[model samples]
Target: MNSSQLKPLLSIGNKLIGFILFVICAFAIYNKVLQNENLNQYGADLKIQLSKIHWGAWVLMGCLMVLNYTIEAIKWKSVIAETNQFNIFQALRAVLVGQAFSFFTPARSGDYVGRTLFLAPGTKLKGITQMAWASYAQLLMTICFGSLALFWNLPFLPWLKWVAPWGAAFAVGLFFYNQNFKGWLSKLNILQIGTGLKWKLIALAFSRYLVYLLQYNWAAAMLSIPVTGLDLSIAIMALLFFLSMIPAISLTDLVIRGQLFLLLMAPFYHNDILLIALTTLIWMVNFLIPSILGAILLLGFRLKR
Candidate 1:
């Protein structure tokens, strides 16, 4: 089909998919708020607890969020180095713009588009594809380790067990499909399909994730929630991270994550609602802060000519 024909079809399909996701997210939010009887009292207590938050901890968390963005910018630059040279500031701006797009778009595919717009004219498409593939590799590695952690934790929830295998299979399939594992690369006539520095890209991505985990841990501490075991926290947080990868969930992403954390850590903390409330607060800081900053960055700066 022609480009014109394909564009409308793609647009319609995306809208349909986005509508479905919106409904699901809305339903999940309604269920969590109304049906989860335990949360009502917890919500009241959470409000009281939040009213007593220490400003010092809030400041520290803010600094960490800035650090997270900085590390992410570095990671993107590392991936881009394989294809072309771009200034760190420019790359960082691109990252922010991409993030802003992700925040608004259902599937967050706008992130790729925003990033691509930042590339030099001749190699834009290739650069975008390469960065995407490299990012995918890192996520795949995370899912692999995370899956193992899940199994080890032996989460009683059947939904938890189902995620690991499905995630692993999807990651594996993506790797082979993108790489054309069966020698399909030759058909494309491209010199390299990814950023040449695969290991560095992976390292940068892995380090970013580590920072994210640390950020969450610190956030939990800030809320004075007791962390009984690192192993379980890691597994649960990893699962939360995996879920965040699913696009178009809206704020359901944060709510579901908070709920899951509560479910998994229930054994450790007698006060499940308080912990979940704390988790929700931490998630807000992690997501909303960046989103607000990214929006500012998007509005204030003009792309360099």
Candidate 2:
């Protein structure tokens, strides 16, 4: 077949792959929710909680979700600025596309693949490397906060104390690791942006992390799960840490996140169904929603590969 004939085949193959992955993820999530007998018990209470939620609160949560991704797009755009100038809309689309691919891959590796595809054809490798630097900043925030939470909950299991220091050390390493990459970074002009951008990157990451926690707390309240103050903060740390450190397919993250909610929140709260509902809702609002929107956006996406 001529190259022209191959282009259509390649495009069809790519779309099919994306669609199949989404279906698999949806099936995994659906099966998990269905199998959870605990979740079934909350059917009526879940409805009640939804009814009690102020329309304003729902609107506020939606706004927060928008803010979350907006910040992320800004971060990605800044990282790629040295390579190419991307408008806010392009950055937003790239971020969503990353989320869409992340649904199927382990450790969300597909995120880089999806994002890099939007770069100038030959610059994809540099684009991915820069974008990954941005991700490292976010991961560092997760590790630091998660370690602190682990320290707070460590007394519960004294034998596991070693993990906290290690996590903290890893966070610290992530912060300085950029120094070792200075030569390569200079080649890509990442270092040309100066230390000011370094600080901005860290600040953006932490701010995004806090937004995630705030959204989760809101979701918890909406589900009638009474979580507050330091306890809630610790749970936030634990969830982010656990999710950050683990290597799992995006679909399985829901199951893992749900179990963590049960384990971490069990002492403070007793409603199993509420815990499941809260986790699932947060997942749907934060992750699944982006992926769905990304899928829609992907219909018009041209795959350079």
Q: Please give each candidate's TM-score.
A: 0.71, 0.81
- Which pairs of residues clash in candidate 2, taking residues 3 or more apart in a chain or in different chains? none
lDDT by residue (tens digit), candidate 1, 1-305 = 99999988877665465345334433433443454433454668777777677988888877877776776777777777756787777777777666655554566666776677667767787777676766676676678667766665654765776677787888766565444333655756463444346656667767767776777677667667776548545656556545746654335565666666766665566576566766666655665445545555544333333
What tens digits encode model 2's per-residue C-alpha lDDT throughout 199-276?
Answer: 788899999998988888788777667777678778878788878878976667877888787888876888877777
Best-matching candidate per lDDT: 2
Task: Show pairs that collide, candidate 1.
Answer: none
Misplaced by over 4 Å in model 2 are: 1-52, 178-194
List ranges where model 1 is wrong by over 4 Å. Answer: 1-47, 157-196, 229-232, 241-245, 300-305
* Clash number by candidate, in order: 0, 0
Candidate 2, after superposition: displacement of residue 152 in Å? 2.0
